[model samples]
Target: MNWYVVYTKPKWEKKVAEQLKNSGIECYCPLITQIRQWSDRKKKVEVPLFNSYVFVQLAESERNSVFQSVGAVRYLFWLGKPAVVRDEEISVIKKWLDTSDCIDVTVGGYQIGDSIQLESGPFMAQKATIQEMTNTHYVLVLESLGCVLKMKIK
Candidate 1:
Protein backbone atom coordinates (compact mmCIF):
# COMPACT_ATOMS: atom_id res chain seq x y z
CA MET A 1 0.00 0.00 0.00
CA ASN A 2 1.17 3.52 -0.87
CA TRP A 3 0.02 6.92 0.17
CA TYR A 4 -2.42 8.63 -2.16
CA VAL A 5 -3.49 12.23 -2.05
CA VAL A 6 -7.20 12.84 -1.54
CA TYR A 7 -8.61 16.25 -2.22
CA THR A 8 -11.43 17.24 0.07
CA LYS A 9 -13.93 20.01 -0.05
CA PRO A 10 -12.66 23.34 1.17
CA LYS A 11 -12.07 23.30 4.95
CA TRP A 12 -13.17 19.65 5.21
CA GLU A 13 -9.82 17.90 5.59
CA LYS A 14 -10.28 16.98 9.25
CA LYS A 15 -13.85 15.88 8.69
CA VAL A 16 -12.82 13.71 5.76
CA ALA A 17 -9.88 12.17 7.57
CA GLU A 18 -12.06 11.34 10.51
CA GLN A 19 -14.67 9.80 8.28
CA LEU A 20 -12.07 7.77 6.40
CA LYS A 21 -10.58 6.50 9.67
CA ASN A 22 -14.00 5.38 10.88
CA SER A 23 -14.41 3.52 7.63
CA GLY A 24 -11.16 1.59 8.31
CA ILE A 25 -9.11 3.46 5.74
CA GLU A 26 -5.73 4.50 7.09
CA CYS A 27 -5.52 8.27 6.91
CA TYR A 28 -2.83 10.72 7.84
CA CYS A 29 -3.94 14.27 8.45
CA PRO A 30 -1.04 16.19 9.86
CA LEU A 31 -2.14 18.99 12.11
CA ILE A 32 -0.46 21.84 13.95
CA THR A 33 -1.66 23.87 16.88
CA GLN A 34 -1.40 27.58 16.30
CA ILE A 35 -1.85 30.21 18.93
CA ARG A 36 -4.61 32.68 18.22
CA GLN A 37 -4.27 35.93 20.05
CA TRP A 38 -7.11 38.21 21.00
CA SER A 39 -7.28 41.45 22.87
CA ASP A 40 -7.51 39.78 26.28
CA ARG A 41 -7.04 36.06 25.61
CA LYS A 42 -5.14 33.46 23.67
CA LYS A 43 -6.41 30.15 22.32
CA LYS A 44 -4.91 27.23 20.44
CA VAL A 45 -6.54 25.71 17.41
CA GLU A 46 -5.59 22.56 15.51
CA VAL A 47 -5.21 23.36 11.84
CA PRO A 48 -4.35 21.06 8.98
CA LEU A 49 -0.70 21.12 7.91
CA PHE A 50 -1.93 21.14 4.34
CA ASN A 51 -5.21 22.81 3.59
CA SER A 52 -8.15 20.98 1.95
CA TYR A 53 -6.39 17.62 1.59
CA VAL A 54 -5.61 14.37 3.41
CA PHE A 55 -3.43 11.34 2.66
CA VAL A 56 -4.71 7.77 2.48
CA GLN A 57 -3.03 4.41 1.91
CA LEU A 58 -4.84 1.90 -0.29
CA ALA A 59 -4.20 -0.79 -2.89
CA GLU A 60 -5.11 -0.53 -6.58
CA SER A 61 -8.03 -2.86 -6.06
CA GLU A 62 -9.35 -0.81 -3.16
CA ARG A 63 -9.02 2.49 -5.01
CA ASN A 64 -12.70 2.30 -5.89
CA SER A 65 -13.58 2.17 -2.22
CA VAL A 66 -12.05 5.59 -1.80
CA PHE A 67 -14.74 7.27 -3.86
CA GLN A 68 -17.56 4.81 -3.21
CA SER A 69 -17.11 4.46 0.53
CA VAL A 70 -15.78 7.93 1.33
CA GLY A 71 -17.82 10.85 0.14
CA ALA A 72 -14.88 13.10 0.94
CA VAL A 73 -12.75 11.92 -1.97
CA ARG A 74 -13.91 14.02 -4.88
CA TYR A 75 -11.58 12.58 -7.52
CA LEU A 76 -8.28 10.85 -8.15
CA PHE A 77 -6.01 11.60 -11.07
CA TRP A 78 -4.11 8.45 -11.99
CA LEU A 79 -1.12 7.66 -14.22
CA GLY A 80 -1.45 8.71 -17.90
CA LYS A 81 -4.67 10.44 -16.92
CA PRO A 82 -5.73 14.02 -16.38
CA ALA A 83 -4.28 15.77 -13.35
CA VAL A 84 -2.00 12.88 -12.42
CA VAL A 85 0.03 13.68 -9.30
CA ARG A 86 3.53 12.32 -9.75
CA ASP A 87 4.71 9.66 -7.29
CA GLU A 88 8.10 11.30 -6.93
CA GLU A 89 6.50 14.63 -6.10
CA ILE A 90 4.27 12.98 -3.52
CA SER A 91 7.31 11.21 -2.02
CA VAL A 92 9.21 14.47 -1.75
CA ILE A 93 6.23 16.14 -0.11
CA LYS A 94 5.94 13.28 2.38
CA LYS A 95 9.66 13.37 3.15
CA TRP A 96 9.60 17.09 3.73
CA LEU A 97 6.43 16.89 5.80
CA ASP A 98 8.07 14.23 7.96
CA THR A 99 11.06 16.46 8.72
CA SER A 100 9.62 19.97 8.63
CA ASP A 101 6.79 21.87 10.31
CA CYS A 102 4.62 21.41 7.17
CA ILE A 103 3.68 25.06 6.76
CA ASP A 104 3.10 26.60 3.38
CA VAL A 105 6.23 28.21 1.98
CA THR A 106 6.11 31.04 -0.51
CA VAL A 107 9.19 32.16 -2.41
CA GLY A 108 9.48 35.65 -3.87
CA GLY A 109 11.66 37.35 -6.45
CA TYR A 110 13.09 36.09 -9.73
CA GLN A 111 16.22 34.19 -10.61
CA ILE A 112 18.86 35.40 -13.03
CA GLY A 113 17.77 35.37 -16.69
CA ASP A 114 14.22 34.69 -15.56
CA SER A 115 11.77 36.62 -17.69
CA ILE A 116 9.61 38.63 -15.32
CA GLN A 117 6.30 40.36 -15.80
CA LEU A 118 6.00 43.27 -13.42
CA GLU A 119 2.57 43.60 -11.85
CA SER A 120 2.53 46.85 -9.92
CA GLY A 121 4.35 50.00 -8.76
CA PRO A 122 6.17 52.30 -11.18
CA PHE A 123 7.23 49.41 -13.42
CA MET A 124 3.73 48.04 -13.81
CA ALA A 125 3.16 45.87 -16.89
CA GLN A 126 6.84 46.06 -17.78
CA LYS A 127 9.12 43.27 -18.85
CA ALA A 128 12.73 43.65 -17.83
CA THR A 129 15.91 41.68 -17.35
CA ILE A 130 16.81 40.87 -13.76
CA GLN A 131 20.23 42.46 -13.52
CA GLU A 132 20.89 41.72 -9.87
CA MET A 133 19.16 40.30 -6.83
CA THR A 134 19.53 41.92 -3.43
CA ASN A 135 18.18 41.22 0.04
CA THR A 136 14.57 42.28 -0.63
CA HIS A 137 14.55 43.61 -4.15
CA TYR A 138 15.69 43.03 -7.72
CA VAL A 139 17.43 45.45 -10.06
CA LEU A 140 15.65 45.42 -13.39
CA VAL A 141 16.93 46.97 -16.59
CA LEU A 142 14.41 47.70 -19.30
CA GLU A 143 16.66 47.37 -22.29
CA SER A 144 14.22 48.54 -24.96
CA LEU A 145 12.96 51.41 -22.80
CA GLY A 146 16.49 52.25 -21.62
CA CYS A 147 15.27 52.60 -18.05
CA VAL A 148 16.45 50.95 -14.84
CA LEU A 149 13.91 50.11 -12.18
CA LYS A 150 14.49 48.65 -8.75
CA MET A 151 11.48 46.73 -7.53
CA LYS A 152 11.04 45.35 -4.05
CA ILE A 153 9.83 41.76 -3.86
CA LYS A 154 8.47 40.53 -0.65
Candidate 2:
Protein backbone atom coordinates (compact mmCIF):
# COMPACT_ATOMS: atom_id res chain seq x y z
CA MET A 1 0.00 0.00 0.00
CA ASN A 2 1.14 3.55 -0.73
CA TRP A 3 0.23 6.69 1.14
CA TYR A 4 -1.63 9.35 -0.81
CA VAL A 5 -2.60 12.87 0.18
CA VAL A 6 -6.32 13.58 0.33
CA TYR A 7 -7.67 17.07 -0.21
CA THR A 8 -10.66 17.64 2.03
CA LYS A 9 -13.17 20.37 2.58
CA PRO A 10 -12.09 23.22 4.82
CA LYS A 11 -12.48 22.48 8.54
CA TRP A 12 -13.41 18.84 7.86
CA GLU A 13 -10.11 17.01 8.26
CA LYS A 14 -10.95 15.38 11.59
CA LYS A 15 -14.41 14.33 10.55
CA VAL A 16 -13.26 12.76 7.32
CA ALA A 17 -10.45 10.92 9.04
CA GLU A 18 -12.92 9.42 11.50
CA GLN A 19 -15.21 8.33 8.72
CA LEU A 20 -12.37 6.71 6.79
CA LYS A 21 -11.23 4.78 9.84
CA ASN A 22 -14.74 3.51 10.51
CA SER A 23 -14.81 2.24 6.97
CA GLY A 24 -11.49 0.38 7.51
CA ILE A 25 -9.28 2.77 5.60
CA GLU A 26 -6.06 3.69 7.36
CA CYS A 27 -5.96 7.47 7.41
CA TYR A 28 -4.01 10.08 9.28
CA CYS A 29 -4.87 13.64 10.10
CA PRO A 30 -2.14 15.17 12.18
CA LEU A 31 -3.36 17.60 14.80
CA ILE A 32 -1.89 20.15 17.16
CA THR A 33 -3.32 21.71 20.26
CA GLN A 34 -3.55 25.48 20.47
CA ILE A 35 -4.95 27.88 22.99
CA ARG A 36 -8.12 29.34 21.51
CA GLN A 37 -9.50 32.23 23.48
CA TRP A 38 -12.95 33.68 23.66
CA SER A 39 -13.68 37.09 25.17
CA ASP A 40 -14.19 35.48 28.54
CA ARG A 41 -12.06 32.33 28.62
CA LYS A 42 -9.26 30.34 27.02
CA LYS A 43 -9.43 26.72 25.94
CA LYS A 44 -6.99 24.44 24.23
CA VAL A 45 -8.40 22.93 21.06
CA GLU A 46 -7.02 20.39 18.64
CA VAL A 47 -6.57 21.65 15.13
CA PRO A 48 -5.35 20.05 11.93
CA LEU A 49 -1.61 20.40 11.45
CA PHE A 50 -2.02 20.74 7.71
CA ASN A 51 -5.39 22.27 6.98
CA SER A 52 -7.46 20.42 4.33
CA TYR A 53 -5.01 17.51 4.06
CA VAL A 54 -5.38 13.96 5.27
CA PHE A 55 -3.07 11.06 4.51
CA VAL A 56 -4.54 7.72 3.53
CA GLN A 57 -2.73 4.44 2.92
CA LEU A 58 -4.32 2.17 0.38
CA ALA A 59 -3.73 0.04 -2.66
CA GLU A 60 -3.76 1.86 -5.96
CA SER A 61 -6.70 -0.21 -7.14
CA GLU A 62 -8.69 1.00 -4.13
CA ARG A 63 -8.10 4.69 -4.71
CA ASN A 64 -11.75 5.49 -5.49
CA SER A 65 -12.88 4.21 -2.09
CA VAL A 66 -11.62 7.35 -0.35
CA PHE A 67 -14.40 9.35 -1.97
CA GLN A 68 -16.90 7.47 0.14
CA SER A 69 -15.85 9.54 3.11
CA VAL A 70 -17.68 12.82 3.31
CA GLY A 71 -15.52 15.96 2.89
CA ALA A 72 -12.85 14.15 0.92
CA VAL A 73 -12.56 16.25 -2.20
CA ARG A 74 -9.91 14.46 -4.18
CA TYR A 75 -6.43 13.05 -4.14
CA LEU A 76 -3.72 15.66 -4.29
CA PHE A 77 -1.94 15.71 -7.60
CA TRP A 78 1.71 16.53 -8.26
CA LEU A 79 3.39 16.48 -11.61
CA GLY A 80 0.06 15.39 -13.11
CA LYS A 81 0.06 12.23 -11.01
CA PRO A 82 -1.35 11.36 -7.63
CA ALA A 83 1.17 12.51 -5.06
CA VAL A 84 2.68 9.54 -3.28
CA VAL A 85 4.24 10.08 0.16
CA ARG A 86 7.06 7.83 1.29
CA ASP A 87 6.63 5.48 4.22
CA GLU A 88 9.55 7.10 5.99
CA GLU A 89 7.84 10.47 5.69
CA ILE A 90 4.71 9.13 7.34
CA SER A 91 6.74 7.58 10.15
CA VAL A 92 8.59 10.83 10.68
CA ILE A 93 5.38 12.80 11.04
CA LYS A 94 4.01 10.30 13.55
CA LYS A 95 7.16 10.35 15.64
CA TRP A 96 7.42 14.12 15.64
CA LEU A 97 3.81 14.55 16.67
CA ASP A 98 4.13 12.01 19.48
CA THR A 99 6.75 14.14 21.18
CA SER A 100 5.73 17.28 23.04
CA ASP A 101 9.09 19.01 23.01
CA CYS A 102 10.43 19.41 19.51
CA ILE A 103 13.49 17.23 19.00
CA ASP A 104 16.83 18.87 18.34
CA VAL A 105 17.79 19.12 14.65
CA THR A 106 21.38 19.86 13.82
CA VAL A 107 22.87 21.34 10.69
CA GLY A 108 26.36 20.11 11.25
CA GLY A 109 29.18 21.82 9.34
CA TYR A 110 26.82 22.96 6.59
CA GLN A 111 27.29 26.49 5.34
CA ILE A 112 24.74 28.86 3.89
CA GLY A 113 23.77 28.13 0.27
CA ASP A 114 24.54 24.42 0.58
CA SER A 115 22.11 21.99 -1.00
CA ILE A 116 21.26 19.08 1.25
CA GLN A 117 18.83 16.24 1.84
CA LEU A 118 17.36 15.93 5.29
CA GLU A 119 17.88 12.49 6.89
CA SER A 120 15.94 12.80 10.10
CA GLY A 121 12.56 14.02 11.41
CA PRO A 122 9.37 14.78 9.52
CA PHE A 123 11.27 16.87 6.95
CA MET A 124 13.35 13.95 5.79
CA ALA A 125 13.74 13.56 2.01
CA GLN A 126 12.65 17.15 1.37
CA LYS A 127 15.04 18.88 -1.03
CA ALA A 128 16.35 21.95 0.69
CA THR A 129 18.77 24.73 -0.24
CA ILE A 130 20.37 26.69 2.52
CA GLN A 131 19.06 30.24 2.49
CA GLU A 132 20.27 31.90 5.71
CA MET A 133 21.80 30.64 8.90
CA THR A 134 21.19 32.36 12.22
CA ASN A 135 22.07 31.58 15.79
CA THR A 136 18.52 30.36 16.38
CA HIS A 137 17.24 29.13 13.00
CA TYR A 138 18.04 27.57 9.65
CA VAL A 139 16.31 29.21 6.72
CA LEU A 140 15.94 26.74 3.86
CA VAL A 141 14.57 27.11 0.39
CA LEU A 142 12.70 24.04 -0.84
CA GLU A 143 12.84 24.60 -4.58
CA SER A 144 10.93 21.51 -5.64
CA LEU A 145 8.09 22.47 -3.33
CA GLY A 146 8.48 26.19 -4.08
CA CYS A 147 8.50 27.27 -0.44
CA VAL A 148 10.84 28.53 2.23
CA LEU A 149 10.89 26.83 5.59
CA LYS A 150 12.26 28.84 8.47
CA MET A 151 13.21 26.06 10.84
CA LYS A 152 14.18 26.94 14.38
CA ILE A 153 17.33 25.40 15.84
CA LYS A 154 16.77 24.03 19.29
Candidate 3:
Protein backbone atom coordinates (compact mmCIF):
# COMPACT_ATOMS: atom_id res chain seq x y z
CA MET A 1 0.00 0.00 0.00
CA ASN A 2 1.25 3.46 -0.83
CA TRP A 3 0.84 6.60 1.25
CA TYR A 4 -1.37 9.26 -0.27
CA VAL A 5 -2.21 12.76 0.86
CA VAL A 6 -5.79 13.52 1.89
CA TYR A 7 -7.36 16.96 1.98
CA THR A 8 -9.77 17.47 4.83
CA LYS A 9 -12.21 20.14 5.89
CA PRO A 10 -10.63 23.02 7.74
CA LYS A 11 -9.82 22.17 11.36
CA TRP A 12 -10.94 18.58 10.88
CA GLU A 13 -7.66 16.71 10.49
CA LYS A 14 -7.64 15.00 13.86
CA LYS A 15 -11.29 14.05 13.62
CA VAL A 16 -10.82 12.53 10.21
CA ALA A 17 -7.79 10.56 11.36
CA GLU A 18 -9.72 9.11 14.24
CA GLN A 19 -12.61 8.23 11.96
CA LEU A 20 -10.27 6.51 9.51
CA LYS A 21 -8.67 4.49 12.30
CA ASN A 22 -12.07 3.40 13.54
CA SER A 23 -12.80 1.99 10.12
CA GLY A 24 -9.62 -0.12 10.15
CA ILE A 25 -7.74 2.13 7.79
CA GLU A 26 -4.13 3.10 8.44
CA CYS A 27 -3.73 6.86 8.73
CA TYR A 28 -1.32 9.33 10.26
CA CYS A 29 -2.21 12.82 11.45
CA PRO A 30 0.78 14.42 13.10
CA LEU A 31 -0.09 16.56 16.09
CA ILE A 32 1.85 19.02 18.22
CA THR A 33 1.17 20.63 21.54
CA GLN A 34 0.75 24.37 21.28
CA ILE A 35 0.16 26.93 23.93
CA ARG A 36 -2.97 29.00 23.39
CA GLN A 37 -3.63 32.12 25.36
CA TRP A 38 -7.09 33.29 26.19
CA SER A 39 -8.04 36.56 27.75
CA ASP A 40 -8.27 34.88 31.14
CA ARG A 41 -5.73 32.09 30.89
CA LYS A 42 -3.45 29.93 28.78
CA LYS A 43 -3.48 26.22 28.08
CA LYS A 44 -1.77 23.61 25.99
CA VAL A 45 -3.74 21.93 23.24
CA GLU A 46 -2.94 19.30 20.67
CA VAL A 47 -3.29 20.53 17.12
CA PRO A 48 -2.59 19.04 13.76
CA LEU A 49 0.87 19.94 12.53
CA PHE A 50 -0.27 20.26 8.96
CA ASN A 51 -3.56 22.04 8.73
CA SER A 52 -6.26 20.07 6.89
CA TYR A 53 -3.89 17.40 5.62
CA VAL A 54 -3.55 13.76 6.62
CA PHE A 55 -1.62 10.82 5.22
CA VAL A 56 -3.13 7.42 4.59
CA GLN A 57 -1.48 4.19 3.47
CA LEU A 58 -3.63 2.05 1.22
CA ALA A 59 -3.67 0.33 -2.15
CA GLU A 60 -4.71 2.24 -5.25
CA SER A 61 -7.80 0.11 -5.66
CA GLU A 62 -8.95 1.14 -2.21
CA ARG A 63 -8.39 4.84 -2.64
CA ASN A 64 -12.04 5.82 -2.54
CA SER A 65 -12.45 4.15 0.83
CA VAL A 66 -11.14 7.29 2.46
CA PHE A 67 -14.29 9.19 1.66
CA GLN A 68 -16.18 7.05 4.11
CA SER A 69 -14.90 9.34 6.79
CA VAL A 70 -16.33 12.82 7.15
CA GLY A 71 -14.19 15.86 6.26
CA ALA A 72 -12.09 13.83 3.81
CA VAL A 73 -12.97 15.87 0.80
CA ARG A 74 -10.40 14.68 -1.70
CA TYR A 75 -6.88 13.45 -2.37
CA LEU A 76 -4.22 16.09 -2.88
CA PHE A 77 -3.06 16.04 -6.46
CA TRP A 78 0.36 16.74 -7.94
CA LEU A 79 1.23 16.60 -11.61
CA GLY A 80 -2.25 15.36 -12.45
CA LYS A 81 -2.01 12.42 -10.05
CA PRO A 82 -2.61 11.84 -6.37
CA ALA A 83 0.33 13.10 -4.37
CA VAL A 84 2.19 10.20 -2.81
CA VAL A 85 4.40 10.41 0.22
CA ARG A 86 7.38 8.08 0.44
CA ASP A 87 7.73 5.97 3.59
CA GLU A 88 11.16 7.39 4.28
CA GLU A 89 9.74 10.91 4.29
CA ILE A 90 7.07 9.90 6.75
CA SER A 91 9.68 8.30 9.00
CA VAL A 92 11.76 11.45 8.88
CA ILE A 93 8.77 13.56 9.92
CA LYS A 94 8.22 11.23 12.88
CA LYS A 95 11.87 11.45 13.82
CA TRP A 96 11.96 15.21 13.53
CA LEU A 97 9.05 15.63 15.88
CA ASP A 98 10.45 13.13 18.38
CA THR A 99 13.84 14.84 18.61
CA SER A 100 14.40 17.94 20.72
CA ASP A 101 16.63 19.65 18.18
CA CYS A 102 14.38 22.56 17.35
CA ILE A 103 16.06 25.91 16.83
CA ASP A 104 14.33 29.27 17.02
CA VAL A 105 13.71 30.53 13.50
CA THR A 106 12.72 34.12 12.84
CA VAL A 107 11.09 34.36 9.46
CA GLY A 108 10.82 37.88 8.11
CA GLY A 109 8.36 39.21 5.52
CA TYR A 110 7.22 35.95 3.88
CA GLN A 111 4.29 33.96 5.17
CA ILE A 112 2.34 30.91 4.20
CA GLY A 113 0.23 31.32 1.04
CA ASP A 114 2.60 33.97 -0.23
CA SER A 115 3.79 33.72 -3.80
CA ILE A 116 7.54 34.12 -4.17
CA GLN A 117 9.88 34.32 -7.10
CA LEU A 118 13.32 32.82 -6.87
CA GLU A 119 16.15 35.15 -7.82
CA SER A 120 18.91 32.49 -7.93
CA GLY A 121 19.73 28.78 -7.65
CA PRO A 122 18.41 25.97 -9.88
CA PHE A 123 14.88 27.29 -9.78
CA MET A 124 15.93 30.82 -10.40
CA ALA A 125 13.18 33.02 -11.88
CA GLN A 126 10.56 30.39 -11.19
CA LYS A 127 7.59 31.21 -8.99
CA ALA A 128 6.57 29.14 -5.99
CA THR A 129 4.06 29.33 -3.20
CA ILE A 130 5.02 29.17 0.42
CA GLN A 131 3.00 26.18 1.63
CA GLU A 132 4.49 25.82 5.06
CA MET A 133 7.16 27.18 7.40
CA THR A 134 8.73 24.93 9.96
CA ASN A 135 11.65 25.30 12.35
CA THR A 136 14.18 23.80 9.93
CA HIS A 137 12.58 23.93 6.48
CA TYR A 138 10.46 25.99 4.17
CA VAL A 139 7.92 23.94 2.27
CA LEU A 140 7.31 25.31 -1.18
CA VAL A 141 5.27 24.15 -4.11
CA LEU A 142 6.71 24.93 -7.50
CA GLU A 143 3.74 24.75 -9.82
CA SER A 144 5.84 24.75 -12.96
CA LEU A 145 7.86 21.82 -11.66
CA GLY A 146 4.81 20.04 -10.24
CA CYS A 147 6.87 19.28 -7.14
CA VAL A 148 7.06 20.26 -3.49
CA LEU A 149 10.36 21.42 -2.04
CA LYS A 150 11.46 21.06 1.56
CA MET A 151 14.39 23.45 1.60
CA LYS A 152 16.39 23.35 4.81
CA ILE A 153 16.99 26.76 6.34
CA LYS A 154 19.90 27.56 8.57
Q: Identify the candidate with maximal TM-score.
A: 2
Q: lDDT per residue, candidate 3, 1-154, as tens digits? A: 8999999999999999999999999999978888999999999999987888999999999999999998999999987999988786677567656766644434469989999887654455668899999878888897754457676788
Using all chains and alpha carbons, the TM-scores for the candidates as numbered come to 0.51, 0.77, 0.69
- lDDT at position 66, candidate 1: 65
Q: Rank the candidates by lDDT, best first.
A: 2, 3, 1
Query: In model 2, where do residues sit more than 4 Å from their true spots?
Result: 104-127, 130-154
Better of 1 and 3 by lDDT: 3
Q: Could you tell me which 10 consecutive residues in candidate 2 have the lowest summed lDDT?
A: 142-151
Q: Whose lDDT is higher: candidate 2's or candidate 3's? A: 2
> Roughly what TM-score does model 1 have, to 2 decimal places?
0.51
Better of 2 and 3 by TM-score: 2
Question: What local lDDT score does residue 27 receive in model 3, on the 0 to 100 scale?
Answer: 98
List clashing residue pairs in candidate 3: none
Worst 10 residues of 3 by lDDT: 99-108
What is the C-alpha local distance difference test score of each model?
0.64, 0.87, 0.83
